[model samples]
Target: MTKPIQGFSKLTKEEKIDWIVSNYTHDAESAKIILKRYWNDDEALQNLHDEFIENTITNYYLPLGIAPNFLINGKLYAIPMAIEESSVVAAAGKAAKFWLDRGGFKTTILGTEKIGQVHFMFSGDADKLKSFINSVETKLRSEASDITKNMEKRGGGISKIELRDKTADLDNYYQLHCTFETLDAMGANFINSCLERFAKTFKQEALHFSEFDETEKNIEIVMSILSNYVPNCLVRAEVSCPIDELADNDTDANEFAKKMIQAIEIAKAEPHRAVTHNKGIMNGIDAVILATGNDFRAVEAGAHAYAAKDGKYTSLTDASIENGIFKFWIEIPLAVGTVGGLTSLHPLVKLALEILQKPSAQELMQIVAVAGLAQNFAAVRSLVTTGIQEGHMKMHLLNILNQLGANETEKATLTEHFKKNSATHSAVVEAFENLRKGI
Candidate 1:
């Protein structure tokens, strides 16, 4: 067995790769070749990628695609989406185009309050702890001033601090819950900096407070960090039109609206359907989040938690047809930033923001929410009418063809052929095989 090697990180890049492959990989030479093959040709770009995280090896690339005709708040946009999925961009584009002539999407920023917490354990007089907490709110803000000065100047700073008692959930558990307005930044770093300062001040002040005994003053700080769950940092995107105008060349307008509402209702009432339903919405949201170098994982976590906010996991979207008007909307928590992190650093991210017309953080939130709503609308419209597989499989045809190793001419021919016949893996494979056999 290969034993653990010391100073593995200190080894030369080539030596480290050789050791790792020699010890673990089945084909060491091929593994090395694959790793080196993905490295950027430009030294500067390679260095930039390496600095994004620790122990970097080679850059991993995802395709960057543009979905055009996104009409949001009366402005036209071509959204950049970076994703590996075959049909996400196509689905989003279809939705955007469908809504473009139908009055487009309208968005509203419900709130912009981010949250953080300083968790601690205190086994002392509950009343005394409560009293101390009330007195420290001002001190917490005052002490965190250094950290918040710049943010305050930009009209973003500490909103409030509250002492939350949670001893019923666990023994001696409590939290200093804090809220802030981060303006044009997602402000994870800024919020975290302020939280750490508050934690330090809360602990140190307890050290010399005359009202506390030796054991009582010994408040043990568990952790101080920003929360990904920012329900108050929400955005709403909705599209509305007269029910009569909802018709297509083939589908009836009123029936289509009712079918769409019924589909949403099913998702709201069933967990099994809601998970997949919400995932389809995230398919579009995550693509834009990733394209702009924001945290999609955080957005995913917050959104799913919000979906379950009613004590049961449900759909993030809603649909209704009433009084000759049909409406579809979604209110989602998305704490994205127009500045900071990779937004200012990554070349592609900068370009993506430029393509977005350099929107403010609030504008970006609106756009992301609109993207999610559009994606869900398209998915549900397909699900209720033509069936989802029709368009999805069509979009997935190129992927299947590539997987079957079709060359230029075959791919071109198959691409045209699939438009006439249904595209499926087995069918494509059989056709390719028959073509190979001169059939």
Candidate 2:
């Protein structure tokens, strides 16, 4: 572990995140060390290092602020987020505050299941190969059964198998998608391991097909990959608030609702806008994923794909106002977990989970879904009222001041000047030395 920096405890939350970023190396191992201290988990410290090397994927950190004053299902939560965008945190805070003024958010979960794919390729007869594989369906299930035997005792296991045809390849290839009920655990790793173990059976079955002699016909097994297309296991939440609570300084309740709806429509109409719109929701989702050391990338890819599932890119959140009440709904493919792997080991993740009081996997997903809904509320409010850039530019000025190395007094002066003169980086830098000298 790196030496603990002095004065860390005295810094504000934003400053602490910035300090960690400035001093810590941006790597999985380094993240594990820092998180371990935060969560007090030594095992997570070891596993993070292992997973980083095994996955061969790089880590990117972002500062996503957690808003306070959240009351969901009559429970208060200090939500964590991992995103780089500006308005998300402030917007969520405002939206939550508005809801709190009314009755706060009420949420629920559906269920959780992830898809695993197993592919088989044949050079000779596709029919024979498909038949051969189908004949051993029971045996195949048995092979996959061992992996989930424990899960079965817990009332979760492989639920079904699906087949698809592809004629574009030179050789006939078949794709088998296996769906499993993962309960509270994100079962990607388990599903992949199960399919890999069953590959030998699939290969053995292919060799026995009558159309292709084992010696002559080339039968190869392609990919045994885990998919994020979680159509089965989905969680949803709906929040309602009195329109009077959403009223702003100049806008009436009805006017605010109409403007929010219009802004959301704009986001739904354009792909570029939709990307940012969905990203706002993920800001809330990814933070929890990171805190638990779950696969954030898989969750991200699944969410965006689910967003575009209807062939038109759009926002993940929907809102409507009726009978003097405003309602918001959000549905995302959130394949996260509370137990196993990094969740049990990573320190900061553990700390985050503890701060959250170790919610069940379903409970955790519910929190994330609510966070997404709150974040969307924030974004739409900004777009409808003062314009998104207004709040964003104000916060960005701090980053600009840091880049210019202005002292505390200089920073305050520069912030005021930039607020008045439309602060540009070059303009700030030009006056930076003079302002520092005066300080």
The numbered model that scores best in TM-score is: 1
User: Candidate 2 — which residues are off by over 4 angstroms?
Assistant: 1-65, 83-87, 123-130, 168-171, 208-219, 412-439
Error of 1 at 325 (Å): 0.7
Residues forming the 10-long window of minimal summed lDDT in candidate 1: 50-59
Each candidate: what lDDT?
A: 0.92, 0.73
Error of 1 at 104 (Å): 0.3
Query: What would the per-residue lDDT of candidate 2 be over residues 1-439, giving only the tens digit for each residue?
Result: 6777887656654465556665665774566456445432355554465454432222345564567778888988887665565556776777778778677888767767778888866555556656665776777778777787998898888887766666585456767778787777877778888778667666765556565566424556798988877755677877777777766687787888887777677777888988988887887677667766778888888888888888988888887778878787888878888888777776667777777778888888888888888877777777777777667667677787777666798788777776766444566666676676664
lDDT of 1 by residue, 329-365 (tens): 9999999998999999999999999999998999999
Give the poorly placed runs of model 1, Cα more than 4 Å off. none
RMSD of each: 1.2, 8.3
